[model samples]
Target chain A: MTPQRPTMNDVARTAGVSLKTVSRVVNGETTVAPDLVAKVRAAVESLDYHPHLGASMLRRNDRRTRTIGVLLDDVSHPFSAALHRAVEDQARARGIHVLTGSLDQDPVREQALATAFAERQTDGLILAPTGGDLGHLEAHTGMPVVFVDRIPAGVTGDSVVSTNVSGAAGAVRHLVAQGHRRIGYLGGRRLLSTARERHRGYLRALGSHPGPAVHDLHDPTAAERAAIAMLRAPDPPTALFTTQSMVTTGAVRALRRLGRERSVALIGFDDFPLADLLDPPVTVVAQDPSRMGRTAATALFERIDGYDGPPREIRIPTTLIPRGSGEL
Target chain B: MTPQRPTMNDVARTAGVSLKTVSRVVNGETTVAPDLVAKVRAAVESLDYHPHLGASMLRRNDRRTRTIGVLLDDVSHPFSAALHRAVEDQARARGIHVLTGSLDQDPVREQALATAFAERQTDGLILAPTGGDLGHLEAHTGMPVVFVDRIPAGVTGDSVVSTNVSGAAGAVRHLVAQGHRRIGYLGGRRLLSTARERHRGYLRALGSHPGPAVHDLHDPTAAERAAIAMLRAPDPPTALFTTQSMVTTGAVRALRRLGRERSVALIGFDDFPLADLLDPPVTVVAQDPSRMGRTAATALFERIDGYDGPPREIRIPTTLIPRGSGEL
Candidate 1:
């Protein structure tokens, strides 16, 4: 038969110390005396006590796992990657570990990942929801959750996001200042809060500046297809604002295919790799994903530390970078 | 007292089935009869037999954990992130989950992360070692390990990396062809295997063609600091070769500060966001991080599946894209 696993009580008894001492040592609290620490360590080693991290965390009076789950649409995305690193850095200083999952922008996958993390009893969750109803999360888990980037409808949580509306409006304003009216909006899924807000910003910005024809082709599922169709229209817009990095790439590809790359001005939201290297360097409204990540992680950690004030929303600013494409 | 957790035997008994049938249902193996599967499901729910994932894994004859630990220097780096996502995608399809930790390029942290993951009994480890000694890893665990990016010295394991030497040489050749005789090299930590390889390539490419004044300022702790020092150098080279993306940013900042932004030529290894948007679009050798990640993950999964064959080193090719900077 396999050996029975030693518990915290065993370690405390072996060390001739109180249960609280063993808890303090296990938790890495520095208040314990050095001699007592050595005794506990010796006893732990002798007992061969391998603490069940999850169980110990759940039973602890403090109720901190010192672990957080980060669910992203795709971990490999440049934006997501930057944010993840920043969050990890911040979490590490507080002695926390990160459990990450890629949802692949699927609602079912998102739900599964969230449920798995919750089952593992992660202290908190930082998620980039796949724009689907996450009602089950609110109903099932009482864990503190902070939404990042795209926010799902009917789900209430603390959120850290870029100023999508203002950023999109700024891009349109820049295009208008360059004497271009008749602008087209290339976006991802309309269901995405970010995409919808950007589209709204485009309309509002266009209304402020007269003579711009605003067309919203909010089909992120097939951005390239939508971009090609928009460009092939009888009268194409002179300027285009592509929301999301993938949409930017598709719009650029469509422009290259039509051989009108330089004829139309373009500005993309969320910068991507090789954007600036294209024929006319692509301009973009760059969101600091790392900053956004740091903010979200900070908020989650604060909540974990007994800050039960209220749900807060933090928006990191985006910068409009002008290149040949945006300048036309 | 806490409720006693139910075991597989109890579940089978309650469901009026054999232990093997219960195991089949839990594993999602399709051999079980439909009626029996329903019965097992009902029993599982009724008894709240939350199958200990690790325990169920061990009970199986194969004893596969179906989980891997990914230890990268910084998971937020675009290259690292891309690779991580690919690995997770592949792992998820196989019912495997990835547990990730960032080492922040610290050897001590890397050791701590490795210990933590091993304690959790991860089936395999995918590491980007901090160029620190990996003797502890070899000594402690018998789990399958795959090294990504920088391979540590004296440690032999399956590794996946980009062709840094040839890629760097190709970049230098491109600059040399563009009439750049004087070139400066900005690199990261020289101890890193990739950094050393890239430096070697830089020397080999410059050796035959009008020996460029090479300044091997390897391993600038921060990009901004490196950028300032490189730009302020007396008799700075006419062209620059940045070995890493962070180094590339430093070079760009330095060039802009010196007002040589439009005049100097640059070719960086590893592309970054908005590389082209600067006054003159920067050229680079782009490595497909996603492919590297997928390949590494595939190799790890294969190893986990009892492929105890000889260890191998796999190198993915990098491509050079010429833009305004290289052309200059």
Candidate 2:
């Protein structure tokens, strides 16, 4: 059995003082008499009592619950996890707790979670919005929203995103400069704006060369299968461009399995752990999700403090690190 | 200005129906006629109306919010992220939302968070408690609590953890079997029970060799520095026993920096992404954080549904994968 902890009442009884006096002492009020304070402190020490600051803060009518909600693509995904941590770091510093959820690209789920935050006393919302129309988000207008990673059409809010279009275009140009014309494109679901923009960049760079073998799929397994099939084809591309980090990993695995690690050139969008450790070390266009998260969170807090200014769209620059894979 | 979303009033006006009729239609009342239903549906589609499922359920006092809160050491850490995903998966299946926080090993923060969850209408809490004295949790004893990853010293609750002691011992024994007598132990913060238990295991496994060099560190930088010093020592250990994934990563970095990866053996406690991709694939005693999270959540839901039984201590087994790094 867990030893029962002494409550304020217990401390009061032990110290021959009122419960209010014990609470005052525990909360560090200096109004109490020295002798009474000493007794209360001794009782508190004996009982190992801790005054619950968060609990009492929530009880006040005007005091903030000091909690925010974050809805991302999926908390388990590496990108989402990194972004979540960045937001958390910013929030944690301000004594604000984060309540997070995975949107799963479902508009219905997004609506439910957002409106639910309205009831949960969450101060604000940060969303990497999915689905076509986030118009209904206006229903929860009183609550501020900060869009990260992906910005939805039909809903305007403060957003922080990466330079997906130019980043992808730059990667394609790098590949072209290496004298490789045939390049397959592995992309994420077209519903995501990042995927669409990356695909557009590929098209823009592809002035010729059969428009590059394109496979737009969601998740790594599907991307891996597509890569395998494309590589096995009669006239497979000598190089490939994977849009997302997950897709990049899948493409890497597929190429390695086919014994073409050095033969096929690849430049992936998004960086992942161990990318530098992979055989030939995967080259990628690295987007700063952490910075995006931090910037979006700062903007959200500004809005939460009643910033009625126009919503701003912040695009972070991307970096291309060439190790070995893209060199081929 | 952001476009205001159409509310029930707007929908009613568009459909030329009463607010009650619109409400009835949105609530899916069977009394509505087919023609009226069609009209309401068209209005709903045009306005993009999404029923607030989370809010409505919360309005009912007796209904469970179906939201479980998880307090981890850090949500961004790969172990925590993986565990969080597992919990979210379990909660999502039952139409539950997960509210998570990172405690960062502060007792005050932990208590504040735990008590705040009490007020936030969380149905259950899954805590990887960092606090040594959690007696104050008695203030909110009504809620169900499941300790995951780390068990609190003073609080009694259900917990699901990996076999840290035996796992570390097994790895140490493996290193010994490989004919390595001198070994160095690189651990996480000693305050963490996992780190302490792992160190104890290391000591237990060091039956003969004058107790291997032990360095208890928190961050990767400290771990890397400690590893460098230990490796450069006059009588350096032939192998290393890293307690956590981050520590393992730091040790790997140090070993690689010194060009001693192939020469010095390492058996890390926790397995992380890209461990297999490292120059010399890292061998590790892999704890199933996902399984721990799933089990902990399952227990939490069981408690939420009135499992008044005694607290449970679930210890999931760990796996040791023999990769290239541990073989030396």
Candidate 3:
């Protein structure tokens, strides 16, 4: 019932002694009576209670913390938040505690957090790694690490990510099929591998007809400006492909402000709450980030449980749900 | 900079010595040169390094972990997610790590997380406490805890919550002003004080004109069903006031599906992303959860800093944002 491995308290209840006496016996302090110690030891043997961290470390082959570090991009973002929830669900089921940190796409912060979590001897780490030189991480920490949402740039390890490139291409294909020759791409930061892969997919789909591609759009204002500028071009894009939900929101805001909600077709990379309730419901290529998180956590847990297999990269497929905008 | 409290590596860099020498100096091993030890000591002093838990415990007037535990209701929820971000922003500024967990409105889970955090020697705790007997927590854990969003029923502590009753009442008043006498209330689970307070507010506002009031609607599906059923009633409600964002989304979905979006006036309790982009942009009694989070975290930090002031219950006011739904 306590979110801990069988504790000394459980032993005390079985041994008919106080927690203090149980602690004394467990710590091998000599002052306790032999009979009480024997009782406590018998109870401990029966209950399988490792007194504390030190005892557990001494007894088990693995110096298990029963805690995992989860470094996400931003827990405030719905995708990251949902992923956190999913990971937590799995960890709770396993009686593990997850310590979370928001990396905020800062590689230095990512490394710093990973280092701290390692210092605490966490069972493993789940990282939605930020871009830049992350090769140092695997060697520097010497800890089991699993990548989530996006693969780490340098070292190949256990990772679960959405098929970003394919999903983006599929979105473009959907737009193209709807007779849209020119589609604007409003993507996330170029530094992110997600953005890069999605951009590649966009280009792959737009092999012949390359439209205006704007990368490094995170804030709604920047996205709105980029979308508006693209809309106002001499040859405007008839359709817009936003790489993220927030970007989609910005583009939608711009459309509404410009009174072109129904005129320009929009399909976003992520699905958000109330997307269908929009004036002209926004179509989206949705990635299952929660499933990705669960998969990544499971993979990490497998590694922690001594699964010595080659690193696997699991790709979760994205789905395109059309409401009103993508068809037009 | 590393997220760790100044480490041996940091001392080595500051003192311009090898990490080995720094470790030797720190560990008080006899092999370190006097000059090197002096340099390391100077660097440690200048960097304000508290070497480890034991050293910090010995040195400090108040043993601080520089880590805070945040137990949110459900971090995946937009409200809780935003709150987490806000709290993290404040903690990061103070060079403190925020260890987060979603309690899922489970009292047992809350206690377990609190105990785990306490075991880890977290400096303080911020809880969006689940409803139940949490009286033992203050005395049992011996940790400073600040409640956010909902108050702890048994024990008194610093808490920051929205003006739920007033907010809901204000929202109902807005709906009534638009000539809606029969309004439906789609609220959250009754176990939550936030939900109960909001329901109380709804009743307060409808003191004279009692309408269809449905409580304990947690998910969007329930909200949608309640809305649909209420709409189908012989004396159906003309307006809907959903207490939460998710509930509002469900009601909106149902209304949209029923093609009664324009017909039924709606005002949601919490504001969410893309609310303004909806066909008839959802009117909401907006609670500033981020600000509430920041306030709760600040209050917690104050307590952590040895502020023995009486527990403060800070109530953040809510705003009624009227777009078109409420106006209708």
Candidate 4:
């Protein structure tokens, strides 16, 4: 038996109209009469003829596909993933879809992903740019773009980021109050805005402290390697402040490897999974990725809705959770 | 002076072609001659006329928007996020965009998200289904769909999952070897395939060994709550086997709260961040989410490329890493 297919003709017949009228209704052409359009739509629904989405979009003004693009540094990271989920949730409520990509912390990949999203004509873009170059966003004016998490050094657009500097300073103050003088900084790539701002806060907190600042640790791409390096150091800082989740993992791992897990105090910038489970639980400056994501999506939707307000920068606050690791 | 908006006419004029020919080229209609099409393309590139993607797609025969949809239980979970990134990476390489959504572990939400994606006419779909019902996938015919992580109870389709049963059995054997006769199984929602399989493995490993199996521990919906319930039990099992990361966190927290941090043995299913940093570093059955993601993506792309040999189920393996927590 041949399968039956529903077509525009069937819808038109059911609505007692010409096929062109059905086509107009399906494409959402505004020229149709209101009463006739409603009848056509009801017939279309009754026949279960889902208008070809691409065709329907074509006949509409503004030509939006009702989709947005989200690009992150690493989707596997807890913060990035949380933010991604938040954005998706908000987009769903607005009857929009989100296209996601991960740069794996590579700039070339980031550019490629952004271009692909734009070429597909995504209505807007949300990116956590890996600091390399962002000339592409400037060149492409077809879509609205927002930067999330880390802001690009050269390019500026709508951005939503955590208060990294203040959060780091707060963490340092908390450590200092606990009488930690020889505090060492564990950081990620300096190119990232969060890392730079966090490092600045570390320096600001240690400004006149009469201790030798061990700026020996530089960028360790992976957490495992960073942890090993810190543990092998001859005179590791008594108190360690890690700038990111990967760095936090590294610092904790290094302390454990050196059999000094309980001796050194540690506070990480990003809260990670099982932080409190560690022998001496970890203290961290926690940023709400979900809130950041919601704000970014809301901003993009507002732009799509023709809100011509000036591009705004939003900073979400961070909290300090004291677990056992920071008390050592 | 106001900037003159470039139009299709200008592009055709520059390329020395008629408006009809330019329209044909822009819409990817096959009637345009090859040589003229090349000239029109060059002119369009120089003019940077990104043909209204929606309109052009509407005119195309295949009706392919070159977009795929990915639905997961929770995108923020480390494993789910890793899988999402992998799928995105693979799709980007093929010049396809990914529309993503999260079900928040709700079956009703999953069904709604699936419908939303289908309404957009996504070329294919990747789903990590929330348990309950999945009649939607069957209803939406001709769309390629792949199930990841947890498979729906009754629905059958292409699936990629970790070797939960074998991995759990391995963990139990390891615990048995370590001289723990009374092993406790902490699991997530029993409806999940991973949870059920892992629990079965625990029972299989403890064949004929009599002990209390506290299957009453609810799903790790709230890790803190689950942790408290497990710890407060009058006679807690000597070794605790947590089947998911959230459960792992809860169990670890419970141990710490009860001041038995170093007294109880704990082995978790999913490897989490800073597991080794805990006082008695957690032992775990570690599954490589990235590898699983890569494999799943490759399988999906193969299916998308029209390799219809048969619907296949691929299983990735997991490994057990012994740490102080399990040794306890």
Which has the greatest lDDT?
3
After superposition, candidate 4 runs with Cα above 4 Å error: A1-7, A13-17, A20-48, A208-236, B1-10, B19-42, B208-210, B214-236
Q: What does DockQ give for each predicted structure?
A: 0.30, 0.27, 0.40, 0.63
Candidate lDDT values, in order: 0.80, 0.83, 0.85, 0.78
Q: How do the residues B275-319 of candidate 4 rate in per-residue lDDT, one tens digit apiece? A: 766667789999877777667777767776778777788888898
lDDT of 2 at B231: 94
Candidate 1 vs 3: which has more DockQ? 3
Candidate order (TM-score): 4, 3, 2, 1
lDDT of 3 at B246: 82
Clashing pairs in 2: none
Tens digits of per-residue lDDT, candidate 1, B1-328, equal 5244467899999999999899899889999889999999999878766555544443455655566899987787777888898889888888777888887778999888887776665789999988888887854566778999877778898999999999999999899898888887777778789988888898888885533333345343365466566556786578888888877866776676677767888888998655644457679999888888899999998898779789889999999987787788
Error of 3 at A230 (Å): 1.0
Cα lDDT tens digits for candidate 2, B245-327:
87888898899889999899999998998687677889999999889989998999999988889878889999999998999
Q: Write model 4 residue lDDT over A1-328, tens digit each, in one string.
A: 5333366888899999999999887767899999999999899777666656666565566677788888887777778898988998898888888888877778888877776776676889999988888876745545678889887778767899999999999998888888898787777777788888888888888877623332324333356465556556786567888888767777776777777878888899988777766667789999999999999999888877767677688999999999977877
Error of 4 at B14 (Å): 3.3
Over A1-328, each residue of candidate 2 has an lDDT whose tens digit, in order, gives: 6554346888999899999998788778889999999998898777666554334543455545588999998887889988998998899789787888888888888887787775565789999888557776755435789999987888888889998888998898889899988888988878878888888888778765533455557777788898999999888898899999878888887887898988999999999986876778899999998898899899999998878899899999999999789989
Model 2 in CAPRI terms: which quality?
Answer: acceptable
Predicted structure 4, TM vs. truth: 0.87
True contacts kept of 2: 0.36
> Alpha carbon lDDT of residue B298, candidate 1?
92
Model 1 segments more than 4 A misplaced? A1-65, A173-180, A208-236, A249-265, A271-286, A302-328, B1-65, B173-183, B206-239, B249-266, B272-283, B306-311, B321-328
In order, the TM-score of chain B in each prediction is 0.87, 0.86, 0.86, 0.87
lDDT tens digits, residues A91-172, model 1?
Answer: 8888887889987678999888887776555789999998877987755666789999976679778899999999999999
